[model samples]
Target: MKYPLLLRFLQYIATLASGVGKRKKLFILIYHRVLDAPDYMRPQEVDIESFDWQMALLSKYFNVLTLEDGLQRLQNDSLPARAVCITFDDGYADNFTNALPILQRYKLNATFFIASGFLDGGRMWNDTIIEAVRNMQDSILDLSELGLGKFDVSDKSSKNQSVREVIQKIKHLPFDQRKNYVEYIASVSQNLPEDLMMTSEQVKKLDQSGMTIGGHTVNHPILSSIDLNMAESEVLENKKHLEQLINKNVKFFAYPNGKPEIDYRENHAQIVKQNGYLGAVSTQWGVASKVSDPWQLPRFIPWDKVPHKFMLRMCRLYCA
Candidate 1:
C-alpha cells in the first residue's frame, strides 16, 4: 500500500494504542547528523528531506518533550501518551547548519551530546578513516602492517565497506593504540574536511536556542577500554568543558559508543552521577518508563524510510 494511505491508518491505531495503558513510555530518538544531502559514505545518517518529514510526523503524532522534562515526567508517572525526546550525538556541524532549522520548523527541541575534545577543528578517529577511504588515490588500502587487512577502495561500495571494517577493527583498541592507528590513517588520507564538528560557538548557540547541551566526553573514548581514573577524567572533564562553554549547568550525558558493559560499564554510570549529571543514555533499544534507570536510559532510532512503517515501528517499540 502507499505510505500516505497506510500512514493515516496507522496514525489511528497508534492514537488508540498509546492511551490504552497506564504505563508511561518515553521513546528517545537518537541521531548523529542530518546531512544537507545524501552522503554515500554515511548512508545510514538521515539527510535534510528525510529528517524534515520525520520531525513533522513527530510533531503531529507524538508529544515530544525535552530529555529533562521527559525524564522528570516519567519519574512522576505523569508522562503523556507516546512521549518522546529527540537527541543528537557527536555534535556534527551539519546539526547546526541543517537539522536545527527543520527542528524549529516543527516546533521541537532536541538534546545535543558534544564531545568536547573534537570541537573546533578536531575530527573523531572514525571520521578520519571514513574520509581517508573516501579520498583514497589508490584502489587498494593496505593496512596489513597494522594487522588490519587490506581493502579495495576503487568504488563507492568497496570504500564504504572498507571504512566500516577499519573502524570496527580499531574502535576498541587501547586509547593510545587507537590514537596511533588513526593518526597513521590521517597522514595517508588527503584533504579531509576540517569543519565536520561543531565549533564551541555553535554549541553555545544550540544551548541559547532552548536546546539541551549534554556531555558525550572529552576525546569520545570507549570508557571500558580506559582505566577508572581516565574514565572519570573523560566524563568529568567533558561535563566541565561543556558547562564552561555554554555557561549552563550540563545535566545529561550520552556515553561514547554507548554499549553497556562494552563501551561503558556500571562504574562509568556512577562517574556520571558523581559528576552531577541528572541522567545518561545508552544505545540500547527500548522505551523508558518509570521503572527505567535514569542513568542508563535506553535509546532507539527507527530507520524505516516508509512513513507508515516508521510510525508503526515506533508504536511497536512502545508495545515491546
Candidate 2:
C-alpha cells in the first residue's frame, strides 16, 4: 500500500518476525548543525525541535550506543536488534547551544566530528558561499566567467536553489581552489555574516557533555580531490587539534563531504589509521555489518517527518 501508516505497520511486523534471530546490523545516524530556526541558505540542516523528536525516537526504538561500543559490538558480532549510533559532523555552534541539551535529556551518547579549521571563529567554505549568495545585491547572479551559469536570487525559492547549485559546483573542486572561489565571492558580496562554527570552549563543552569528540579534517576538504600529503595532514592535524582542545585522546575521524569513493579514497582511510584513529565514518547510506570496514563506516541523514517511518527505516536497515 502507498499509505505511510500501512507501510510502517507492515515493516514493524516483518521486523519482529524476520529479524527475531538474525545478526542485527549497526545503523549510524549522522547530522550536521541543529538550529533554533532554519537558515534559509542552509535548509538541509535540521531544526532543534525536529532533532529533539528524532533523538527521542532513536532512544526509544534503538539500542543507542557510543561509537566505541558500537564498533566493538560490530567486531564481536554481537550488535543488539536495532543497534544505532548518533553522530554529527562539522562542529557548528548550535550543536552545543541546541542539540546537546536534547541529547542530555535523552541520556544518549553521540559522536561529534569537528572541522578544526572552522573553530575559533573560522567559517567553512560552503558557508562563505551561502552567505555571499544570500547577501548579494544583484537580483540575478552571473558567474559566466567562472563557468557557472546565471542564477536568479530575487525570490526566496530561487535564492535557495541558487545557493544549493553553487555549493554542488564548488563541492567537486579541489580544496584550495574552492577556498579561493568562496573568498573571491565573499569579497564581492558585501558584508558577510559572522562565522557560525563552534568556538574552542564550546567544542570542549561538547566533549564534556558525555559525547565523543572526533576529527572531521581541517577546512573540511574533499579528500579525494586533494593531494595525498595534504589529505594526510588534514586528518592528522585535525585529530591533534581536537585532542589538544579537549585534553584527551580523540579516537574517531569523519571524512569531510564523506562519500566512499568520491569525497575520499582508500589511501585516505589508511592515513586516518596511521594517524591513530580507531575508525572513521563516511556519508554512505547503509547499515554497518560485522564485516564492514571500520574506516568507512556508513552513515545517513534521516529527513522523514513521520516518527513511524523514521523507526521503520531503522527496522528495514536491520533487516537489510
Candidate 3:
C-alpha cells in the first residue's frame, strides 16, 4: 500500500539523518516511467518536476552514481558517507527521451534494466491495461457485457486502488497465461501502437549517454510462479539477449515485481549469481549494507509527487 501523507512526511525527515553508524551501505532508487505525458489516463507515478527536485535534493548529500559504479564503490570501500545509485526497470521510451537528459544534466548516470520480449513486442501486463484505460474514447467500457467473469474493469475511475485491483486480477494467472490475457484485453479495449517500448535504436541512445542496460528477464514475469527450469531459462536467456543487443555483458538485474519474500526466492538468487550477474535488486525498502545480499539488493520507489516531507522520509532511511 502507498503510505499516507503525514506518515510519509515524517519518513522524509528521517532521510536527512541517514548518516548514522559506520555508513556501510548503498541506496538504490528504482524507477519505471517519467511523468510528462499529456494524458491523465496514462498517469506515470513519477513526474519530471518531482524527479528534478528529488535529484537536486539528493545531490546535496549523496554522490549519485550508476548502479554499476555503486557496486564498484561498495567493493572498493570508497563510497561516500551517504551514497545513492539510480536504476530504471523496463526499457521505456521515456528513459531515453525524457530521463537521460536530466541525468546527463546532473552528471549522474543510471542503469536501465530491460525486458527483452518487450523490446520488439513486449509490454508489462499492467501497462497494457493502463494504456487501454487512457484511450477509452467512449469514456466508459461496459466490462460486465465483455464477460470478464469475476474481474470487473467497468469501473473506470482513475483512483490508485481501483487500477491496482484490476492489475492484481489480470496478474492472477501464471506468467504466460496472464500476459496473453492482458494482450487480448488490450487489443480489444484500445488498439495501441505495435511498440510501446524502446527500440534497439533507442537503447543505443541510452548507452551512448552512459546509461548501462541490465538484464530483467526475457519477458517480465513473476519468476517465483514458474517452474525452476523455466525460471533459470528466463534469466539466462535475457542476459544473452541483452548482451547481444547492447553488445555489452549484462551484469546486473532487478527482479520484476521484485520483492524478496514474494516475487523472488533463494533459488533465483543462486541462478543470478551463478549466471554471472554481479548483483540483483529487490523492492525491499531499506538501504543496502555489506550484510545485504548482493543478489538481493534493496531499492525504493520514488513516487510521482515527491514533496519535501517525502524527502524527509527518505532521509530517515539513511539515518535509520
Per-residue alpha-carbon lDDT of model 3 for 1-320, expressed as tens digits? 13587546544454445536357578898888776743354455566776776666666556777787788878777777678888899888778877888887777888999988888556667777776665555534444543454333344454333456667765646887776667666765656656668888888778877788898998787888888799899999999988887788888988888988688799999989999999999888888877777889989876636456556656667767
Worst 10 residues of 1 by lDDT: 13-22
**Best prediction by TM-score:** 1
Q: Model 2, range 167-190, lDDT digits (tens) per residue?
A: 898888976787777777787687
Q: lDDT value for candidate 2?
A: 0.84
Against the reference, the lDDT scores of all candidates come to 0.90, 0.84, 0.74
Q: Ranking by TM-score, best first?
A: 1, 2, 3
Local error of candidate 1 at 14, Å? 2.5
lDDT by residue for model 1 (212-319), tens: 999999999999999999999999899889998999899999999999989999999999999999999999878888888999999997677767778878877787
Q: Which segments of candidate 2 are over 4 A away from where they belong?
A: 1-21
For model 1 the local lDDT of residue 24 reads: 86
Better of 2 and 3 by TM-score: 2
Candidate 3: count of backbone clashes, pairs at least 3 residues apart or interchain: 17
TM-score of predicted model 2? 0.93
| Clash totals for all candidate models | 0, 0, 17
